[model samples]
Target: MTNSLPEMAEIWQQTLNWQPSDHQQAQFQRLYHLILEGNRQLNLTRITDPQEFWEKHLWDSLRGIALKGEFITSLKEGASVIDIGTGAGFPGIPVTIIAPNCTITLMDSTRKKITFIETVLTELALTNAKTLVARAEEIGQQSKHRQAYDVALIRAVGTASVCAEYTLPLLKQGGLAIIYRGNWTEDETTGLENAVKQLGGVIEAIEKFTTPLSQSIRHCVYLRKVATTAVQFPRATGVPTQKPL
Candidate 1:
């Protein structure tokens, strides 16, 4: 808790064309302290340093939605969003802070992680977010979750094709799936295209950028659902990883 988070208003504006309000910034600081406290018992995240957490977790998470100098308009208009495999609530929590109007569900298979996020929600008084302890494959097949969200976010979950399998099925027609990755390739895009097609989606865009602090390369693959995914999609539990797409 000694290392306080930086305001970095200029950096935020220059990088993402947006900056957190004072209340949101305070919530971000509180979230950081909660994560550090939770890490002692739970191993929540390795990036404990304030600057690193700000750059990698806070800034990096928000950057995924800031395309072409605009935050996705749907987010401001109260869209329903689900963050698949949201371990320790990276993009979802940051997103919930920024997009206060949108309703967010943070899904993770681990109950402990979900429990930690619930604590974060309560401590931050974030009324717009909720936590779900469930597998991606299971939720994608469930009636309540299938084709339910306007935006589906995933990061560091799996391969591109596998990510497509997990997210595409849960999105409504015309919904978007944002898959975050590091070190992308043309071969990977080809593989992803095939997978997304089978799941009733198309590759909308592939954005590449450099991390602000470390200057590391990152990619966000956007898939837009144009048709209903086959009922067989997402496969059985453990199947997406075992035999992706």
Candidate 2:
């Protein structure tokens, strides 16, 4: 098995029109090692092979936050970001490494996972990133975290509507939520539309793309928070998944 992530600079430039600096490259490589090590004690992730790790975990994570040629401007402008259910800190950690200006909070209900991420952040010396041990439903009701972020990211966490419920209440009006998925359909879009609208968000755009290496289908649903979410949101822990929107 390959044990090292390839420094695919050309792939980065060709696909996202963005390239990591030498320091960022080193950080990415280090991140790969750390996740592999952490996987032994925790069921962190199954994508342990280096090449697969780079494409699925690193590139795919960053792709969700970018457009054709540029990253979301808010990220460059020191946006406050929250990654709901950040199990292994894919996009949040990578986003923190590349866009040091943004402040990212990696939240997960599992304490062990958050503890592992805390170690990763410390070892990486990522001052801009922090870890949170809490459920999205509970955090959305907390005054300190509610509507405090400019952008919210969620991947492999739950359904699109569940992701919206977990992320929307934690964002300020006009904040953006990126929902990452392996596949999407028109029926899913219709369900998501109603769910988001009720959560005070609008379906801004949906992007469909394939990974550079695996060529697997992927979708990113971008929702813009247009109004204040109702206080009842997040509807108690596990309720979002059980009852959904």
Candidate 3:
């Protein structure tokens, strides 16, 4: 069952001009099983159909892997990465699947989500991935986690400001925090400037691309951490959402 999924992933990768290595093939197989099991027990995601999984779940997760090649290349093979608010392992699991050399920490506040991720990791034989059942804000402040990651990936999570607060603190200075968002206008970018600045990040770029099958416009906001976040940031969890910086 897992074997067929990688064949599908390879086809998808070929469509994007990417050729998966033998190791990547194995990873995709693991991802397929993980998603399948996760779907059975919890609302990890809504796109359960196999075809929809290929397009919406697999491809959507792989987009970050595709765009951040340069960043991934710079990391030490098996460097640490953290995915905050990793509701269903978007980007993290896919990234772990494609980039076998990198170790990933998939963190979500919900215990069921973490359990689902753990089960997938174990089933897929993904030795480099781990799941944390904790809030992003609390993890970002822990001495062990703070400024510990080489890259931080987030998706469809929150406002740019709030996202930055949650993600940037977990990154070492000069690391990158890639936020996946829907299409945004110039006004939205302008609105986020102060929050980005406040969180010690600079908007490096706002990359726009269309989904392979859907042709839906999507945006990836790349922010680079320039300095340490002030202690006040990530403000008590719910605060960041209710009163964004």
Model 2 RMSD in angstroms:
1.3
lDDT (10s digit) by residue, model 3, range 50-139: 566666766767665445333345344666888888887787887777666888999889888888788778777788888888887787
User: lDDT per residue, candidate 2, 1-245, as tens digits?
Assistant: 34768999999999888899999998998899899899999999999888899999999999999965579899888999999889988778999998888899999999999999999999899999988999998989999999999999999988899999999999999999999999999999999999998999999999999999999999999999999999999799889999986
All candidates: CA RMSD (Å): 0.9, 1.3, 2.6
Give the Cα-based TM-score of candidate 2 against the true structure: 0.98
Residue by residue across 28-66, what tens digits does model 1's lDDT show? Answer: 999999999999989788999999999899988998987
Candidate 3 all-Cα RMSD: 2.6
lDDT of each: 0.92, 0.92, 0.76
Q: What is the TM-score ranking, best to worst? A: 1, 2, 3
Q: Which consecutive 10 residues in model 2 have the weakest lDDT in total?
A: 1-10
Local error of candidate 3 at residue 54 (angstroms): 1.7
Number of backbone collisions per candidate, in order? 0, 0, 1
Between candidates 1 and 2, the one scoring higher on TM-score is: 1
Better of 1 and 3 by TM-score: 1
Which residue pairs of candidate 1 clash? none
lDDT of 1: 0.92
List candidate 1 segments past 4 Å from native.
none
Clashing pairs in 2: none
Q: How much does candidate 1 score in TM-score?
A: 0.98
Q: Which has the greatest TM-score? A: 1
